[model samples]
Target: MVDADQTFVIVGGGLAGARAAETLRAEGFSGRVILIGDERDHPYERPPLSKGYLTGKAERESVFVHEPAWYARSDIELHLGQPVTAVDRSRKTVTLGDGTTIQYDKLLLATGAEPRRLEIPGTELAGVHHLRRLAHADRLQGVLAALGRDNGHLVIAGAGWIGLEVAAAARGYGAEVTVVEPAPTPLHQVVGPELGQVFTDLHARHGVRFHFGARLTGITGQDGMVLAARTDDGEEHPAHAVLAAVGAAPRTALAESAGLALVDREHGGGIAVDASLRTSDPDVYAAGDVAAALHPLFRTRLRVEHWANALNGGPAAARAMLGREVSYDRVPYFFSDQYDLGLEYSGWAPPGSYDQVVLRGDVARREFIAFWLKDRRVLAGMNANVWDVTDTVQALIRSGEPVDPEALADPGTPLDTVLPRA
Candidate 1:
């Protein structure tokens, strides 16, 4: 069933692709593995780009998924700075940017996502930044430090996780931060309206200003440098630098050009894939942010952009490629560390999907577990500054049994005992 004559080609040298290659070898596949990416750096984890790396708490080497030598040691071909320009699904080949075509028995696309730019003018001005790649973080880390030392102002667009984490890092450097968000509060789409305020207050207490319900209309700059950012409400905020954290768009050009079906825009577009990460063509697979996978639990196509998704999904995809019985139904999960607040969220319960937001533990002290419930069933849970309960919470969600609200809120009550048709 297996042969060394087969070659597995993985595009995109991010965490997902690298992990897939690793899993292929770990799964006892001795076939040739080629990993391609546009970035000059080796595969690296992204979370540090917005968190620890920005704060100077993490070293440059820590961001890498594996040492540069590991790829060579593992006998995996690493092609950094060469992006796969096209995919020929019928021919079973991928063309690199340099026009080199490689034949593959299986192809995994982990092209990941690109940061969305501001449509407004003056974005090209100096001091305008984005934080999606290690290269961006390398530059922004110095920019934040410079701004802090000079007592400069940094205005950020969007109050999403990237924007807020950068805001926290800016404040840690003693730089002024003003966040412009289109929503009424921060992280509205992810955590919902109720929990959004929690982040808003958290950042406010740390001296970060927020301009809610506003869009960037224009940016004013001087001498090829950003001076201020203009809001739709006709207000201008001073800025030495501006970071756009609006969002990221999945990189699906290769998949689309190859005639692979993609999820519709309304369903959060990405390369459409089945539970096993197989695209329209069974030989082709997509993972990480570029894949909109059919989740057995959610019973719908869901695309997760978090690091955990890539970390786990890549291995899952590799197993599937090996013709193993695979079901990629991992719970949607992500974590954030902003200032003193560190949180881990599990399961998917975006706004209207849940009936109510219930809290347990101390809210004022910022040590609590919040749950999103529907018909008394736990859909999702987020524990902020509270450790060691994620396993219990995930168990509750998987049980699919109604949980007693009173018992869930009681500190004396153990969470495992509150489930199963309560």
Candidate 2:
């Protein structure tokens, strides 16, 4: 049971930490809440950093989860730019970078994740970058603006969502862009080949070039600035700037050092937690990217690095901390925007788990909904340029009822009507 006088310490002041603190207050927990972050800025949303903020379509101030004043008003202690160096579970306290030891009865680890840095040579060059924080996006934005229209070539190292989004934004700035991926198609691992081809075609139509089944061996530089990228295939791609969008790994050092159990590295390394988001230690909880929790719907452990998971998981963890009967059971969901294409995906179905993909609407025209099915049961679904059907898509996955492919493909059939009756 949580005592009202005990301090609740939250590490990692990102969206997850902010939301957790908000949940604590809303749940009537009058305990002292301290939110610690290594970054100097207030908690902010990262999705915009790759899209609107990088393209100059959104302001920097707008990305913050809440204004600085809100923390003070909420009576939540904000410890920005302070890294927690050690977690002493025995002492029930954490030591900060500044040598301050803070005691906590309940602790939440929301350490989030970091962008995977490239090990290739010339990564130290001035024009080489990676987008994970506001500062990185700001630097890339400046580099793009300086390049002007077709004045420079931007070579992207990976063809994942971040790579594709940055490619669209760079092209919008009139910079020639090229994307290289080890896979055969962009997002092939996530959305599968057919749907991935849709994105590949979309970028190709917008003047973005792609090099599939390729690996960036090293970066070549001229006078401390990146000039080109050398791939394993003996091709040198001209690059005025290079953005490494390879992917990210969860920040699990703190949790690991504290002796908390983590998921296997092969299955996405992060602190292991139950359905209620409680860690190996009942006094400690975890949420957001740092948590690999059991998903009741999937009947497996899943860790999502998307914005929606952080937005919902934090609150659920907080409620559980207060001894409320809660389970973080929402279907995993995420959305991305590139050029004119808008995408929303719900549920999880690993590659090869789904035997067939059912397509509704047009794929070539860049407007459609696609569902991944296993044994004629919906496992996951995604919509491109399609609006207001996410709820129905999620319901289908939750219902776990076998659905007919023909009804799903028919435009006249409303999505809600396709579900099995309760």
Model 1, runs deviating above 4 Å:
1-4
Off by over 4 Å in 2: 1-4
Query: 1-422, model 1: which lDDT tens digit per residue?
Result: 33559899999899999999999999999889899989999999999999999999999999999999999888899888998888887789989889999999999999999999999999999889989999999999999999999999999999988999999999999999999999999999888887888898899999999999899988889999989999999999999999999999999988899999998867889999999999999999999999999999878899999999999999999999999988999988899999999999999987689988889999888899999999999999999999999989888888888888999999889877887853
- The residue pairs found clashing in candidate 2 are none
lDDT of 2 by residue, 1-422 (tens): 33448799999989999999999989899889999999998999889999899989999999999888999888899899999999999999999999999999999999999999999899999989999998898888988887755489999999999999999998888889999999999998899887888988899999999999889999999899888999999889999999999999999999999999999889988999999999999999999999999998899899999999999999999999889997789899999999999999998988989999999998888799999999999999999999999999999999999988899989889889899887
Model 1, residue 204: distance off in Å is 1.0
Worst 10 residues of 2 by lDDT: 1-10
Distance (Å) between predicted and true CA of 150, model 2?
6.3
Candidate 1, pairs of clashing residues? none
Q: Superposing all C-alpha atoms, what RMSD in Å does each candidate have to the true structure?
A: 1.5, 1.6
Error of 2 at 379 (Å): 0.8
